[model samples]
Target: MKKFVLVGVVAVCVIIAALIGTRMLTPPPAELDLARSKTSVNGTYLASIEPETEPVSVGPVHNWVLTLASADSTPAAGVTIEVDGGMPDHGHGLPTEPQVSRELGDGRYLVEGVRFNMGGWWELTFQIESDVGSDSVTFNLML
Candidate 1:
């Protein structure tokens, strides 16, 4: 009887551990309704980068979401937007490779894995390309 009870306890413990691991691996939900903070890239198209949280600080990881649209306010869906950011004064890019992990429709792209090691003047450049055309925009942030 003691052996059976011990086996059952171990099995239960394993199941609980598995459940916790699965939860930790789960990705957080995307921010779909972020506000559009515009950055003009030659006035040909309208693009915006909205941070998942407001008042973006220094020395912390953040996910900066993007929304690209035409001048007439149409979402530039199916367009590919590449994100690269660095501190110009310091002469180094972000510590992590920030990427557009997923497209949340309506010209929305989720940029993940962004971390600023130190605070200063940072320039985030977005390379936008699609059937419409290709252009680049840079946003200067002073943390």
Candidate 2:
């Protein structure tokens, strides 16, 4: 009877551990209704970077969720915007690569996951290319 009880307890523990591990491995789904600029890239539009808050020093990791708005105040959809300069000087350390966000097809771009390995201001002058003329804008982000 003692041996059977101990084995039962171990089995329960193993099952509980498996369930906990599965839950931990699961990642939260990406938000579909994400925040975005209320503007699209147009000729009469002015592109600028507005920091949501003051930059703080976190580890070597930080993320930025940016939205490209148009002059008419709508999310810029299906538009490819490029940042030339990187980091906080132009934007946040130009993460060595331009963060590409998937277009939700509703005139909004979603830059879901951005990881900055350093802390500083990345200066980036970006240009938007589309069927319309390229619109250049500057972003100064702090990481």
Candidate 3:
């Protein structure tokens, strides 16, 4: 009985190690050009905000994918990006503070916690900071 218990413990440890190794070795998500052109100041960079969820209605959280690229079509990796926006006509900001959750590598990021309380000409702005410089772009969303 004791021998069986010891073997089980060893098996568990081995399984855990394998899982960790798999995660460490796995590559990040591929960058995709999934949305319209949203460019930074003076066309120094390009950004696109693609909604992952369809029928992006109001009052429900949504997932957005942000893709950044340089003017020369290079991936803008290892950069700090900020997201914020709201109804400009209504003079208010987003109900929740949206943020970049995952760095998918190669200028691709997963932005989560996006909720539009009441949608009517909403603007989603992205501020990017990288080695080149810092600039911002906005996406006008109509719902």
- The candidate maximizing lDDT is 3
The best candidate by TM-score is 3
After superposition, candidate 3 runs with Cα above 4 Å error = 1-35
lDDT of 2 by residue, 26-143 (tens): 4333332222222223454444343323353433333344455556656566678664564322232444555545554544444433345555443445567655456765544444
Stretch of 10 with least lDDT, candidate 2: 32-41
Q: In model 1, what are the clashing residue pairs, if there are any?
A: none
Model 1's alpha-carbon lDDT is 0.77
Tens digits of lDDT, candidate 3, 96-133: 99999988988899999999987456778888899867
The global Cα lDDT (0 to 1) of model 3 is: 0.81
Can you rank all candidates by lDDT, best first?
3, 1, 2
Pairwise lDDT winner, candidates 2 and 3: 3
- Name the better of 1 and 2 by TM-score: 1
